[model samples]
Target chain A: MDTIIIDERIDVGAVFKKNIIKPRWFVWKGRKYAITEVTYTWEDTQGAARVMHFALSDGNTLFEVSLNLTSLEWRLEKSSVV
Target chain B: MTRTILLIDMNAFFASVEQAMNPALRGKPIIVCGRGRTVVTTASYEARVFGVKTGMNLYQAKQACPQVIAVEGDMSRYIDASHNIQRIAREFTDQVEMFSIDECFLDVSKTCRNEVDPQNIARAIKHTIREKLGVTCSIGIGPNKVVAKIASKMQKPDGLIEIREKDIPVLFALMAVQKLQGVGVGRHISEKLMSMGITTAGQLGNTPLEKLMHHFGIMGYRLKRIGEGKDDSPVDSSGGNELIKSVGHSHTFPRDTRDISIIRSYMMMLTEKVGLRLREYGLMGKTVYCTIRFGDFTSWGAQQGLKEHIRQNREIFFVAEQILARAFPLSKAVRLVGLSISDLKPRDTQQFLLKEMEKDTTLAEAVDDINKKYGVFTIKASSVILSEKFGIRPSCGMVSKQALKIKV
Candidate 1:
């Protein structure tokens, strides 16, 4: 997969269940998309900042999203469709 | 009494992980490769069927299978999967030796309970790996590691085989002598053995030891034991599961160059990678080694030991440059340059270096912190800043979960 590093900030809504964080919806580029399923979840560390990377599907498109814990910011790191 | 050993080999590991994570890549011909690299690191079963094999350049792989999809390999994903697999293996036996990123050996002799057969344990391990990891593996159960390793490769994709002592003679009678593990005596010796009418493992095993030793020296004894399906090596699981021998990185230039500046910059970049890994693992080494592969494929390496153990980029690069200079006055253009630090020991106490050393240590810590927070290369030494400009990407070779010791 070609990983395009897009560090632009985006809006994300997540749910905390049983100490697990799941992304429910996200907004990017003035568009709101509801996540249908999360294909994979992984944790990455950047210095002291911990980021949660989620490969989520919005029914038609697959997007890779990252949430920075220290900054509490969400970024769309990559996308599989186009 | 024979001890039970099991070898678990992941099928097309990198490609399989890519397929497992991406639904779009499933069942399609895929080849995992480094960016701008022609060599195929791993090929899916779909691509392999069309004659695409590991180490085949992209041009050759495409020639064999035009529809092959090339994906840049992500070492982190493979490393994570390997850790999960190792955890699964530990559920059966604590004696799990991670052979590589995609293979491991487990000594289940002590853990094989009275009611369950050794084969059953292998089956359970395979089942859990498939269900949890969404990947398949072939497992081989044998009286020892060598036989288990050979049996693991007997079937492709997903296979299970058990090799008993009684099965050795018949199973190896038709097997090529070269198929035996640790028999890589090269083509000349293989040809000599073939000339002696020793083409099969059974023949090699049955050959007189004195004659074999007279022909091949000490290696002949190892060959005989491997041919007889005997391996006395134990599965080592000390040091939190993975035993790391060395931390190093090597980059092959797209075009062979003789420019000293370019080569030095590449060396600096590699030393940074090695140093980062060393500090990450809380390890330090006394020896600095450098390797240079010329355009003719002939390689030369040199190493030097330091009185003080080091895990900093500047120190590693300084020592590596010294070693490289010792092998200098290049006879030809350099194709690849690699740096590694061996003779490793855990970092314990620091020696006082007065002002300069303390300043360097503080700077290194700050830089490491920033890079670890942002991403690698977010902050790098000025000497290595041109590494990306020169297309000197960090090499990802056989990443093991044990290598990445993430501190939680």
Candidate 2:
């Protein structure tokens, strides 16, 4: 699979349950999409910044979203079709 | 009272995990490597079918299969999957030993009853791992750890094989001598054996012990026993209880450099990583070792003993720099640098030092706490800031709990 790096900032709607953050909805490039599932989650460190990475789907396409905890900013890192 | 050991080996673990996570990547040839590194770390079976092998550079792999998908590896995800796989093995038997990130040995002799067969246990493990982790493993069941390891390699992707003691002779007769575990005879030794007209496991096993010993020393006897499929090593399950020998970190520069400032910054970065691990494990060492490899691939190593044990970054780097100074006035530019600490003892609670030393200790502990809570390099030494700016970090090696975890 080919990966296209898109470091664009986006809006995310998340929920805090039992000390865990779950993304429920997101708007990317002016298109709002409802998240059907969060397949996997992981953490990575770039220098001092901690990034929370999520692999989620919107019923048709899969996307990788990264949240920089230090700045509280979200970026769509990459995406693929189901 | 024969014991049964099962060895589970994951096939193309890094590439397999990437395929499992991405539905679009399944059933396609893939290679896993670091972002800028040329060496291939893992290749899926699809890529292997096209004659691509590990350690091949990207250019060579492309020549073998031009359409191969190359994915930059994520070590954290692989580590998480390894922990989960070990947990699944423990469900079958408490005697589970993690041999590496993608391999484990489980002692099932005690767990199996008259109604339960060892093969059934292996099947259960394979099924559960596939269902829960989305990975496949090949399992080998034998009378000992060595035979079990060999059995695991007899097939790939998803294979299950059992080698009984009574069948060792027949099975080994058809196998290559080098296929035996722990018997990595290099080209020279193999040529010598061939001159003696001995080429397979059966010929080696049938050779007289005195003649083999006269040529190869004690290792010859060990090889003879291995050729006969007899190994007494037990599957050790004392992971948490195992003693800590040494903690170290090493990095190879993308390009060889003669710049003293760049070399010193990299040294400090590695020392910080080593010190953090030592403190996290509640251990301190009195000896610090430094290794330097030159551009021509010639290497030098030296160690120095300290008056007191140390588990702080500055102290470790200070001792390491002292050793480096003795080896300096370089004959050639440096290619790689490594730092390790050994001769360890548990941390002492009593603090008997000057005010400045005590203050430094407190400051180091505070920085460690913050980095553990947030992420690595969050609070590093000012001298090592250049390392962060240049994105210098430790190269990946064998997987260990201490190497993977930032916090307990």
User: Per-prediction TM-score of chain B?
Assistant: 0.85, 0.88
lDDT of 1 by residue, B1-408 (tens): 668899999999989987777777889999998766667989999999999999898899999999888887766667677778888988887888888778889998887655569888988999999888789999988888889988898888899999988999999898986676433445677678889999988888899999899999998897788778787988877624455688888887766888888889889888878888899888999988899988777899999989988898988998888888876788899878988998899986668669887888789878887887677888887877666786754434445445633222
Which parts of model 2 have CA positions greater than 4 angstroms off? A1-24, A34-53, A57-62, A66-82, B181-197, B207-221, B252-258, B292-302, B305-308, B325-336, B392-395, B401-408
Tell me the docking grade of candidate 1: acceptable
Model 1, residue B64: distance off in Å is 0.8
How much does candidate 2 score in TM-score? 0.84
**What TM-score does chain A of each model score against the native chain A?**
0.87, 0.91
Clashes of each: 4, 0
Best candidate according to DockQ: 1
TM-score, each model?
0.86, 0.84
The C-alpha stretches of model 1 lying farther than 4 A from their native spots are A1-7, A19-21, A48-50, A69-72, B181-192, B239-245, B252-259, B277-286, B293-300, B304-312, B325-335, B343-379, B390-395, B404-408
Which predicted model would earn the best TM-score? 1
